[model samples]
Target: MPHGKPGQAGSFTLGPASGDVNTAYRYRLTSGSFDSGWSAYKPGATATIAPVPPTSGTMVLFAEAKDNYAAGAANSVEFVVKEGDGPVARWNFAETSGAALDTSTTDQSLRDNAALAGGAVRTDRGRRGEVTVTRATETTPAVKSTDSGLKLNGTTDYAVTSGPVIDTRASYTVAAWVRMDVPTRNATVFGQKGVNRSPFYLGYEHTSKKWSFREVNTDAAVGTPFSYQRVESKRPAVPMVWTHLAGVFDAVNNTISLYVNGELQGTTPFTTAWAATGPLQIGRVHWSSVYSDYFPGVIDEAAVWQEALTDTQVAEESELIDAHAVPSVELVTAWTPAGAQGTTLRDTVSGYGSDLALSSGASLADDELVLNGTTGAGTTAGPVVDDSGSFTVTTQAVVDAAKILSKPDGYKAQILGQRTATGSSWSLWFEKTGTRQEPELDENGDRIVDENGNPRTTPVPVGRWHFGRLTADGTGASVESMEEALMDTETRLTGVYNARHRTIQLYLTSDQQASDGIAYTAQVGTGELAVGKGYLGSWANFLPGRLSDIRLWAGALSDSKQVSDVVGT
Candidate 1:
């Protein structure tokens, strides 16, 4: 039989009859001839038939009784058809050192065409790597078990090619299995673009930490600021871990939807006219002006579809990614990345204390260290809290500077940075010293006033305070805040390491209640967790603000109703 399940259908074909003039062929079963009659045989035309299997057991069919000629010997045949059509474009990323190939039926292949020569970064930690690709004894899905994946170094690594033009204004879906190194910045997963007013893009916003789907329409006129239509997930993506992401745009309904790990995140109405006419970029946006949106991390089984895949299909795709993920539950160390300026980075939980002094430029202002970005500040002991398995770390602070914390390795392991440099993480920031507003200017450079005869201009926000908590655990990582800052009372940011769930949860509140929060899978590394100042060599990472009441917990805090008691909410 062809290649189908017990109750599935299969198609069979018989060769064109030959051997004599006016010859014909008829097919039959062992019991009797089939009800469908056969006719004259042509030189090239073959008879095709589709039949559903009656039961699980095998069945045989016979062919070749010729017409106007002597009967020929019967030929037996079998047919089996499998269920489901595969992805339109699927990249297994099995190639370790060369171009990324498309394993889909479209033959749309992509080579390692990095725009910059030294841009592509190669690592051995792929899912199906030199060793991890081994198959399990149990019956696992083939797509999930196939080994190997690609990792993109945030700075420049990405895979690009042209030809697969999927219409964003029509029904379509895009999906991928992603493992982010640091989930910040406007990181693009995959997009096609060429400066055509508006294009389709799926990316994560570093400042908001939310997954977004955007369709641009530059032709929009005034009073329609909604020209840049988008549907953002209600929550942010967990940093430094693997997650399944899928976005579907249905033009008929003028709605867009996003899914994380097979769950429907949210759906919103969005109507816009846009087009994309550039090379299909895997890790970055195609527009040259916005190269900063390049994806930073590993992507596997990236795919695109001409039709919106049903929720069921997205669930199956998510399962494929989960099969390869191995959960970790070990706690390496936990500490708040904030302390007195010019002092040692003290550990609150594991007590893996470090006497490593900070750079002289670091100064204490109201108990928190103020870094000038150029000054070096961190623990002297390298890899102070190194753990091979898993870990959870949490800290809370109010920062005015944008690049609040970074590691020494050229800002490679940044802990937290402002979403927008001028603003704080949780609070609205206004520069300590700046004019709030000026007279509004017209196109002719003349001052314009409103109907009330006053300067018709909006107040420019110059500064704002920023505050929030940062968490990193085995399941994932995140920087979170309670939407706004609590001016009178301090907000508590809590991170819990649930090894059993192989995930980390983040909570933010001022009333000591761990209410609704975001959770993500964690990223594993041996690098030491630093605080206050990062990018030691460059002098570009310094808190320049205060850090207070930093503490840590040993493991996943018990799920007690009084969560605030453990880590003040």
Candidate 2:
């Protein structure tokens, strides 16, 4: 849009999209009824509307691409005519020096007064912003800003707003880009402090293991059971990824909604709402006469609005992270050069000081470790393996059938695992020649009879590959793929624990797909991660093979191409 002085006739150009894409445009007053129906989509075409943008109040310019398919999410820019500018307060954390400035409004009172405590430091790794509010008070059009965010160190790190930003008793909306590093406990993205319980909170709820929006019905420190009402997302929150969360309190509708990414996840009806007054705490919650649930992650573009943002408004904000952007990933460790640091296998990822100590019983050659079924193994030497909820482990190895040491039932060979005295956090191994119990069948599929008239039975051979995992709640299960292609061949095996889906996937070589992954979750055990062997009770299930490479990622590598690339087709 071309802008001149506010009073001059307004002239806006709907230019052809880049890459010669076809685009359409429309405009309407956010609070008024002047609507320009979507213009015809055409490449290199221009469209003009007789009505100019509102000289006051608010106007929205909506644009959508019309190529072979929708190129991206519809983008709408809000141009508002306001006194001080747009949001009540905005913390971009983009400052190179001095306190981070609040750029949305000019009111000195509403400026950035949040204090960074503990290890909360400004970081350049933040979301790719896609929306920015343009106010008529500005001399130029608004441009989206992609800037740094505050990294909260989970234990004591946080940003405390000097004072409350919005009236919690009334309808309001609050949002931020949150990248959770871990979900060991309930974590807060933003929480309004009060005498006791905060009036509203948006973050991961420990009970449900889901992103949640919490609102209390009373302002008093002591409240009835009905005072606490929360709406949790249908999907569990996956750690080590950046996500946009918006908590909307609609006093008019008597409902509270939580939006994940950009879409409304779930809404809960409330009987009443109360105001919480005090400083707004980012990355921590105060309640029960003590501060707790300090967030272990990063927060960016934290803002508050006095009004309940409509669905369109929320969707527009969701666009901050492009609809097509590849999901963000946090690499916890990558143990490369398997034998890089002399006798110890050094983790090549900088800042992550994980090294694997190959047992003296094992021999390293050509960056590969050869483990005998009885005497060889390698274990994580540093403080690794604490990523409990979601993780991926990929390895390339060849299992020698002879080393299976097949007992009467079968043999087990551990490829990777983190096990402690109490239970196994996760384990992947090959259960070779195990038998499946079933009724014996005669030629016609009928159960065969035994001498005493009891049904005859036979043991059926179960396939080799199996993955085992335990949830934080103590439940555990192991799933085996019945493909029967025993572990004798060199293959890439990728095990993924996606806490979001509550499932575990074992991916074999790219040429084939293991049916569906067995469902599983993660629990961090006290033991360090070990390759070639995992403990069941007495450090058993040793692998006798060449383990060429093994790498662990914090996020799930579920995408087909992602698996193929990481594991090699």
**Judged by TM-score, which candidate is best?**
2
lDDT of each: 0.50, 0.67
Cα lDDT tens digits for candidate 2, 94-153? 777546567767878657567787778987555532223332244776454444678888
Deviation from native of the Cα of residue 89 in model 2, angstroms: 9.7
How close is every model to the real structure, measured as TM-score?
0.41, 0.53
Model 1 score (lDDT): 0.50
Give the least accurate 10-residue stretch of model 1, judged by summed lDDT: 422-431
Best model number under lDDT: 2
Error of 2 at 562 (Å): 2.1
**Model 2: colliding residue pairs:** 130-320
So what's the TM-score on candidate 2?
0.53
